[model samples]
Target: MRRMLIVDDEPLIADGLYTFFAKADIEDMEILKVYSAKQALEWLDTVKVDIVLSDICMPGMDGMQLIQEIVDRWPRCKVILLTGHNEFEYAHQAIRNPCVADYLLKTEGMEKIRETVEQTLKQIARENDFRYQAEWFQEKMPKALPQLQRQLLLDLLKRRGAKAWMNLQEEFDAIRLPFRAELAVLPMLLRIEEWGSYESQSDQRLLCYAAANIAEELLGDKAAVKVAELDSRSLVCYIQPHAGQLQQHGLEQGWERTIRFVMGTLESIQQSCRDCLRLSVSIIAANQAVQWGGLQQSVNRLGLAVFDSPGHGMEKLMRLDITGETAGLSLRQDKLAAAELLLEHMKQRLLEGSDDWMCSFRQWVEITGEGGPDDPFLRLRLLHGIADVSLRTVQEAGLSEEAGREHDLAPMLHFNIHTRWSDIIAFYRETCQWIVLRRRDSCRLDESHILMNIHHYIKQHLDGDLSLTRIAQEVSLNPSYLSRWYKKVTGRGISDYILERRVEKSKELLLGTTLRMQDISGQLGFSDQHYFFRFFKKAVGCTPQEYRDQRKGAAETKM
Candidate 1:
């Protein structure tokens, strides 16, 4: 069943729809009834709602404002606007935004809302299917090389599984070549400029897949491409190892031509919404020899700029100029300039590199933490960014020449230095861990934080008396509120997480010590061993004795 939120200024209208949804066997649906947009936004901050049925005319914040916020922050939530007026002008403007899934007149009755919600949910499920299918294709589809080659690419980008990557490198010695390489990641930003007033979700999904297909074509053995929706207005085609040549002049010419070709192809595929289409390509380059933070950061930086640009077809390559002397205030200005320049500067620093370029790039990465917005993530991304840039820089440079000279520049590029990068990265990660812990300590909310301190308390006191009232009192929340919020946030009731934890504890005692099953059951606060057995079987798919037997048999087999 889909989770839905009904936002209407009128209590009767909200209650009517809520009651209708409940009786329709969609009652299993987690429904949030909000009398105004204010309550909706407040609840939305914590709940993972799937659909919204909101009236257009509410005090303070209207349906339009709610829709805008949903689009901005919760892009995945489908919104069906319930408006009284039938002005085509209003419909035209409201539907212009991609996040407004459907608009219905309040006079259409409760049944219409039910049908609209069902259709919206069905479409969402189908889009999720498409997403999974695309991922499956990414997993199974072969490139010009074998599975080993693809894994080698992943290993190089991630700076992991050195032995396997090395074995592959040795095995594919004919294709192996290294050059002065840096990693560049390109994420396709699909900005819908003017989605027609009656645009369907299927059309949007088609446009996204069409963009992905075009990206795969242009990228052509250069990068691994995948599609995702970054927000309401855009979809992303994440391309890894974003590296090309600055050697031959054709590299620039070819890249520009490729951009045109991709734009044209996307236009052709999404011909229906040609006027609505906009594409922004963002690239981040790092050293190819080490790991950066993660691919997600690069994708985020690239995808975030989609709405900031205009025009239907355009390409912007990130470039950096580091040959300058500055001090104090001048230094701060240059740093700000670099941050503002972002992808452009990094792109230039990658393909056009000197010793000065490397030092400047490294310094930028050290300061910004691989273009990460936060500290821990920043450091992780920096390591990843460095490896990506170095690997792709080496790979592209080598690809320009013959593949035979792979190992020639590997030593000079300090390839050995990256092998030890994991250690330094581990140290950096520890610092990030501290940072994350510190941030969590300061920034987390007390009222609706999903971390479940109450659950922790329950687990600690499970052996003693435990009841809903006692538990609610301990958490300083009403029993009813605790039950609902716990289920909503954790996808299970308090009793459920607690029961599972107790069973887990009991299993440890059963296998690791000589405790009897009855004693273990009692120790876990189960009234009877029989009841515990039933609960264990229901949750674990095995009785306590059967679990112990299976473990013992596995141990024997291992011996």
Candidate 2:
């Protein structure tokens, strides 16, 4: 249902309009009335008003100002300015605001006003329909085929245990994977070590796709290779022996030959990336092949190995020797794999501004602490990843200088100084906590600065043009956005603030000086003495002379 509010300072006119709307044959509309813009706003605080009919000149916060308040509160609400004054400037200004449907003089009959309101309702309905149609179109559109395939591979790699692979073949066939579920596969993890000048996410993704294409081109003849980019920097390729080669050379010989060819082709892939793309990457291949059920474990181990290795400045081509690492896969290795995955998850959360990343970090620390002794390489990797994200956040938020002064930020950059695992964890937590707090402080400071600028401008221009549009221009913000932001931050409408300031200034002038009423009204930016008198009486509950005389009588009594 739609709601309409009629605002006019005069009681007869406000009631008359309400009675006319209530008796009219308008459908689905709840009509209300208020005596002033301030009362209208107070009603608007709780009720969702769909249309407002207001006088362009009121005692406090006139119709022009009310338009901004309505825009801030109920953006879709239409306003019709009603005034006795037939000024072209007033109509032009009202027409400029998108929410203002019409500027009808009170001389225009009730029929014209009601017709304008009905038209506004239709406009609102059309806008709502367009929004719904746009949303429907978005929902019905299909995602890209490559994105679906990548997501499937990522899900498969993260799945655990044998039960998870029950429907693996059907899922693979859905995305047209070349290999069957029964065949053993080799998983190779690739990490892009350096992108040189390609820093943006889109550029890096293009490089990753190009690099994968180069790998497929080099090793496509020997094995069935399918690559899925796991993140911006890492990709995993699943390789299986081609059916023709396996049938011709036997399973064991063909599989062994395919593995050798893959290993040999890594050098060529690396060279191609360097020569053509000018990018450096690190590659880690599993020492032995695994079935679909064991693929997750092999990929996890390789992920940890690739991430833990020191590949900061150079490309690394290494084989993950899972067989040689302790007799069987140990608990420590599993914990390390879990930790690596958690860190990656935390990185994403940190970028998205979620506090859950801190919880993930704490869980990683607890897992690391419970895993008996710590690996130096694991500690170094954690430190590097955490410090990188922390510093990047600080820099992006423009808090680097403050962070440097508040804590020992230098140690975060140099991981060699932290000798103990506990020291590393403690320092990282401290840095993260500081970053979170400082970011909040910086946001508060920014908000305070904006409010200060707005308040300053309002105070400075009290006698000049204090219209919402002029105030918005002074603050360098859209009038609607400025009104919304101010109300949200200060918990009061900007119009209310302006009214309060004007009242306070009037009181000061009445008590402190003997300025003539007309001069005082002009100085306060009122249209005339009569408007100022009504404004002061409405706010102070007394005329200007009465207020001054009451204060003088009280002062004389005190003396």
Candidate 3:
């Protein structure tokens, strides 16, 4: 069955079209009715509709924008537009875009609408057949080498199984990567830094490709290297440590020697990259060698290092442990700069509400409480570092504007240190949570203010147009955006509230007025007495004269 969604802002018009299509003889068609383009887009997000017949003049997201979204999201779904004569020019511009099968002037009547729908359905049916046939042959195509290489690496990294390894070895031999099997390798992470400083590089992917080629050439003499760009700023270079360089007793005999050689090659890699690419590169050398089974751990550990120690980014060679700890807490001038740099990184992560920051927070608390330097002054310094990060996080998150909270770290500064580790950790958690609560309360207050302004404007402008466009301008918002926000705040469209108010006002005028029906209609901004009468009858179950007569009869009887 083909599904059709009809969207229009007029409740009667939208419902009328839904009822008309439900009764149409267009095969086994399923029909849905939504009052605005915003609602139609929400429906599209959850369900795929075969055809969309949308009015181009609704308040939220007009038909042209609606069709554009439909074409972008469900390119196969056909759209037929229904627009008023005044909007036909706007609709014509949209007609030039794809996925719009046709548009009809609403005055063209229901017969034309039925005909257009039938034609669009025939096209959709033929397109589906073509798609099915095309996909059947396309599935039989061969896979490419780049895809095979990535899959092989993933399987090895995951340590899939013994048979998987055998398959990988066969694939490796076929690709002629004999250097890969030559034993122990180190996972040294390379992060491209100051990339924004490069004026000539416009394409980041091409630059990364060039960097990988450069690394291969620089390390060619000392090591067999495989480099992969990990993300926008990071890369992974698996260096196969030359066998002759490792001492005979599994590297125990020359651990320092291995470190020296690796550092020299890293300096060469960094300097060569600067000379050739005009880009700075930072390398984080792991403390030990790792095989395929441990690759994931290496990635996570290194990823945390880059995040937790953003200051160490310039240090050329950083030896990172899994604890996310720096060697000293500003124990010297260099260490103090490192500490400040690390806190700057933490402050940013806290603003982003990163769960990784939370994990690092917990680990830092535990590590410092148990294994930090025994000196009292050092432990106090560590406490101050943690406090600095939290205080800055609250400031950046804008706590001062909400709940009128003071943006000061005096409480954290005056907090008394205790011997118990739990006491210290508890204090940190309590302060962070308090700021978060204050910020949320302030946001709710702001939303309430916006709602009050909307209500005030509607009541003040009953004689005016009172249309969404005018009211949205009063509040400095896009009409469609205001529509969604009003609905979200009040649980119904603004039009629904306006209609209710109009009905209530008509009841009062009918009871209290002695004026002619046309005069009363003019006061309500209705187009004419006839439109006013029809609207009253639909809402009040009686014509305006009838409603007045009934009210007079009730008053006499009560007297």
Worst lDDT window (10 residues) for model 1? 320-329
Candidate 1's C-alpha runs over 4 A off are 131-559
Residue 477 in model 1: lDDT: 76
Q: For each candidate, C-alpha RMSD in Å?
A: 22.8, 11.7, 11.8
Task: Estimate, for each residue in 242-320, the C-alpha lDDT of model 3 and write its tens digit.
Answer: 5565545355544445555676778877887788777778777776666554565565566556656657546355766
Rank all candidate structures by their TM-score, best first, as comma-separated numbers.
Answer: 2, 3, 1
TM-score of 3: 0.49
| TM-scores for every predicted model | 0.29, 0.50, 0.49
Write one digit per residue (lDDT tens) for candidate 2, span 492-512: 977689889899888888889
Candidate lDDT values, in order: 0.56, 0.79, 0.68
Best by TM-score: 2
Tens digits of per-residue lDDT, candidate 1, 311-370, equal 433433331111222112133333333443342344344444322343444445455543
